[model samples]
Target: MNPFLPMTRQDMENRGWDELDFIFVSGDAYVDHPSFGPAIICRLLEKHGYKVGIIAQPDWRGEEDFRRLGRPRLAFLVSSGNMDSLLNKFTAAKKTRHEDAYSPGGKSGCRPERAVIVYTNKLREIWPGVPVIIGGIEASLRRFAHYDYWTNRVRRSVLMDSQADLLVYGMGEKQILEIASDLHQGVAVENIQDVAGTCYRVPDFDYVYDYVKLPDFETVAVDKKAFADAFADIYLEQDAIRGKKLVQRNGEACVVQNPPAMPLTEEEMDEIYDLPYQRTYHPMYEKAGGVPAIKEVKFSLVSQRGCFGGCNFCAIVSHQGRIIQRRSHASILREAKLLTELPDFKGYIHDVGGPTANFRRPSCDEQLQRGTCRGKECLSPTPCKNIVADHSDYLSLLRELRKLPKVKKVFIRSGIRFDYLMLVKDSFLEELCKYHISGQLKIAPEHISDRVTRLMGKSNKEVYRKFVQRFKAMNERLGKKQYLVPYFMSSHPGARLEDAIELAEFIRDLGYRPEQVQDFIPTPGTLSTAMYYSGIHPLTGEAVYTAKNPQEKRMQRALMQYWIPGNRPLVREALRLAHRTDLIGFDKKCLVHPEKTAGQEKNKPRKRR
Candidate 1:
């Protein structure tokens, strides 16, 4: 149940309900990714026969309204994102503040205020006896002290501040369902310790069976100072098999290094997508609506899961595992056909892609046979532990999607790994340029400097440029207007002012201007954040370059956007402050005299006839 939904708890009580079963809340817009977070838990509980509801974009006020819905014996689950927010402070569970009441489709560019943090604590204040579960991207990723990208160091764990009964990590569908099944049958939620991926506080410490363990989350009250101190040295290990200290209590913690939650098996994904949105298997989405009208819409679909492109700043591979799982071509076509029959089917399929869009099977099938991979984090220096990097089947799937008569156009909107795409055959590239040209293709080259790019585990920026050139040339020779749109990041650890300047110079040379610059937000459990916090490479555990604030990051970002003639003075000033004016323009000669640059000219340089 989305927590933001209006409630009529008293009406439900009058309808003869002794006690409510379960409730769910999320910060996500709640678009229904059924397999993730509350969506999964709700579906599983329904199968086991329990009344449930979700609250999306929750409102913390009117605590009485929530209690009036059912008796004291109830269970609640809360989530903020696809991953955990960086607010794990164990001794103190609830943040003593509330966020402004900005609804969904609102609140775009702003840091959450102290008020937003206190909004969730209202549940505990109102109904002290009910069981509350907080899991999801924000909770899971920040289950322990982790590097805070914005502030650039390990911060407190989230479990302490939110004070939920349980904080689950990984895919919690199965875990949460079993916990609820036992609870509805009258088992006390506190006694449910066998549940995997669950974090809670206990009365005393015990020897951890494996890497780490946690006390019941409820037992821990808010201790902001202790929580902050605990994470003072916390950071991520990019090459970690279990993802660095899977559990932490004060200074003590466990390292159950794991990757992305299990990906959808090809068969399972196929079955999910084929569900003619018109007639879903269960009443979950398709309640008896106004009519059996032709509800046809072209939907973008995920073709594979997990990524092995060990980019230090990312956590996708950590959460989803490096191995890619692909849905079958036939399965995709089946869904495409269903879309065509829809009343609104516009004969255009948005796209069929996932993580990298091109990678098909898990990276390494051979490694899978050898049992679990030792190299868990996909963002690593070594070749992916799962070596089965095959994309042919995926290419085939795209060809078939193009053939569907009802499908007028297919845009590869989900991102593509240009390096991997470059590996694709020339004919495939030509066809891709010819058929799949929805004007532009999106890719993440990250940065241009080789050292910085290598640190992020991304391909050389040169490769991306070449890829763009190939794409442009292929389309142009065919008289088609196609373009390459690359995504780049600034101020990743190891990216110093020199590197930023080089990237800016490269972009200037390419004659291609970026529409948007991605300012990195260090999510709770990412290696990049870890590297940023400790100034250490996550894999090698070696110290590396790092930046400490938004100002430094912003300057690096500005360098890319204002690389033309007019901003040379600004770049000079930034470089002087950065102590990186050893190169041209910043040399004493350029600094002493003001010379107008192409950036100042505005229009492209006039070609000297």
Candidate 2:
């Protein structure tokens, strides 16, 4: 049977079903591709012999928009699409975004703010007593009481705010299936508490034994130190094997979090990938630019999942866990072959990696047996002795894909852990520079200052410097004129005015002006966000400096792009504030030249620090 889940009541009527077992509410236009979370969850439900329907990007102002599909027989599944909804609607500076790739026509404001909470609340208003289960990146990251960067304050768990019956965290396949099975057996939604990778609200914590109790919400809400302390404990206990159940009190009600779900094995991964995906947005969106996000991944393959890079600024470890799980080579090749048969395959495969491109296996052998260590990292300060730095499997997989009939090139656009790449002594770099690169290869070094880099849990600039030397050497040897586009961030926690100045100087020396620069966004689940909210390092509990002022943040961003004529005023003011006016003179070493006469500087640029 060709199982494409219905999106409307008439579609369900055509299939001889009176009512759907599940109605999935999404904040994005429905794309049936496997890369989309809502599509995968809905299809997985359908494969289990349940009727499922979708309500994608419905207007959330009142009950009229949510009434498209009446109500499901079992429950309603809610998600904020692939990316977090807040990140989709706003930039790091809290400015409203003008484009949403997940929406039709690349329009913005199609979804509500704090989408999961807003959608769930509106669902309850329309369909009273319908069980609501929330998942996806937004709910998963905010399952517990944590900071909310948008409001600049600590907020309770999304479970409490949204009033959803249950919350599924992490990769939700196993948990969602278990919930469905129990529901099919007539179990109440309120009683589904013991499932792994889930969270539920309770009247009290009396029945929850042997679970770690975080400081109550009230304490953490008012005390910065307490918030950091609670966050550190949560970070350490994310391991599936070593973690215990967690409990947190929010007034009279308590939130209980089950341990993370174990990673899927190769066979399980193969089954999930082989699920029938339409691999593009529904035909209904063809006139509206076809969901701009699909253009990046339409021909790409997902070779792996989960990251062991353990960067503090990233939430992958929290959401996907630290264990590295991947699909088999045969499985990926099958997907690539199917792509060649697609009408849109244009001889190029855009990407072939996940969270991190080069990670093919666990960082070390023991990770599968015993979970990742609490306070240690795989490749930040230094690579662990037990770390296995091999790319033979991934390299072989790429070689097989390249030999496919219609495939012309395979690129690795996802992040590449340069620190790990530098540790391996092989021809991988040469091959990457020669074949996989799309004109210019992109890598993230974040920042160069040792102080800021340490706080971000990234390797120091020395390691990045060495990698740059090797990358240049490899390109030279291969007789290719390729460029290294390094990603840099400004105004991260622990970065001072002086540090921003240091970064501006580094950009000056590199002679490369970045077209895009990211200001650190303190999304809910990451360690760096905790520090940004509490002004204390979660692991260290030490007070860290944060550039929170609006003008200061603009200055830091402007300094990174000092070459822009429009940004000269902000850059000059930033330099003066840092007491680095010596850099404003007309010298080769200076960032900006001194002021000159209108005629004398007509061709010359103006400097007004």
Candidate 3:
């Protein structure tokens, strides 16, 4: 059996290793699956001839759990699991979430808030000079000075706050190996500043060269325009091919972020996924019922990585970069066949996609050579003219997967870029509706208002409407009764009360009741989050309306699910606030009925008493 990485001293001794080259510390329970970031990083290190161990969800209050594996010879790789800790532990309302999918038995509070910073601080206190390199979603997104939604303030770069020697951003395999090789050659961590896709702090300007200087942390913390400007500079230079080095000062220290690592080739992506992952949570957590997050990805195959559908609210572009990196179909098929051998697969492949399911290649051929266009999106406002928007490769891949023996059904559960879908003049949709979708195909239009959609970097309402009509027509032609489950967000920056009301009206007209609506959470390092914090669009330098007040946010959210009886009062209040009381009436178009007075109730005709 392929065993998990050593997690305890005995496991290390069982492997007959005297010393480990690296000890990975993560805020999530040890799930030795490719879907888990820590697992991938550790497995990749192991593949590269390094003896690595893991310390998963160690107690932050003391050093006892931190010392389980002892110090590594090279460095301690740290991460806040797959998600940012605050996002995992708190709802969009900032209320404490009771369940953490990444934790054992789905328990919350397994890790502290600001886990990257907390874990790094603890490690620093215990092992003074050992290198602590922070990455994963928490460190990657927070590598720069950013708006902290929990604190409602601008915070310094995670490198400075966590006091980590180096911070790896984006997908970390390339950077981690480079850092490891340098350290193995006896290069000091402090001197390892030139690695791409990493951020390192320097005492002064002496270490900075050929870099774009963002507005200092102090200036951005106080000045909204400065904050917007700084974020714009940061956002524009995220491309690995043409991106420049970035520097920002936090008090006396300067944080320098090198250009992103080059996109992984097909062979590289294949190699990473082909690592001998045990493909399950560690046995130690079986008593606690294992990690809940594994259930979603255990039988699923990740067909691709990185998304080009640059939704402002999504951080995929920031974390995974825009250039599409996908595994060859043979590799994905190999994984699919592996899933068939699993005891619990049930002949069903849960999903076969990534951030944007349909994106199997770069948005356009030019992006590969010149990087993503500066200040221009491939499929937003409208699909770029140069975008290939081909689905042949993806469709072929899906067809091959469906033919694999013992695979009864293959599904595409990940988000499909509908706008990109619309661009493809092929049988992709027909195959999708007939084979992949299970009665209902979910799509994210986000909002119906063109104004909001523009700000969201999503295709307009008309695009979604056209796609809906096509989907319905296709389902009808196939004599199938399929429905569209559209997702909409509430209270996003640039979305006013009226916009929310308008969305409710659209839902009312469509005769669709949304069971679940997403409320915008302004997490760090996205354009939407920057707009939410600064009240200005970072890229456009224009004022954007954000519903920051809890009451107003509630009202906006209530408008989306106006059909819910419990949300009626807030819906009514939102209608009144938006001066859209016209929607509160007896008409079919009205979202809610007017409140009946006591006198009116008394005057109501009784049935023949």
Most accurate candidate by lDDT: 3
TM-score for each model: 0.76, 0.96, 0.98
Q: Which ranges of candidate 2 are over 4 A from the true structure? A: 1-3, 596-609
Better of 2 and 3 by lDDT: 3
The segments of candidate 3 whose C-alpha lies over 4 angstroms from its true place after superposition are 603-609
- Superposed on all Cα atoms, the candidates' RMSDs to the truth, in angstroms, are 7.6, 2.7, 1.2
Record all residue pairs in model 2 with backbone atoms less than 3 Å apart, i.e. clashing: none
Which model is ahead, 1 or 3, in terms of lDDT?
3
> Which 10 consecutive residues of model 3 have the lowest summed lDDT?
1-10
Query: Ten-residue segment with the worst summed lDDT in candidate 2?
Result: 1-10
Ranking by TM-score: 3, 2, 1
Per-prediction backbone clash count: 75, 0, 0
In candidate 3, what are the lDDT values of residues 354-418, reduced to their tens digit?
Answer: 99899999988988899999999888888888989799999999999999999999988999888
Question: Whole-model Cα lDDT per candidate?
Answer: 0.57, 0.89, 0.92
The sequence of per-residue lDDT tens digits that candidate 1 reaches over residues 547-583 is 6564666667778776455556666666778676654
Candidate 2 lDDT by residue in tens digits, 403-503: 99999999999999999998889878988998999679899999989999989889998898899889888888988899989898999999988898898
Q: State candidate 2's TM-score.
A: 0.96
User: Model 1 lDDT vs. the true structure?
Assistant: 0.57
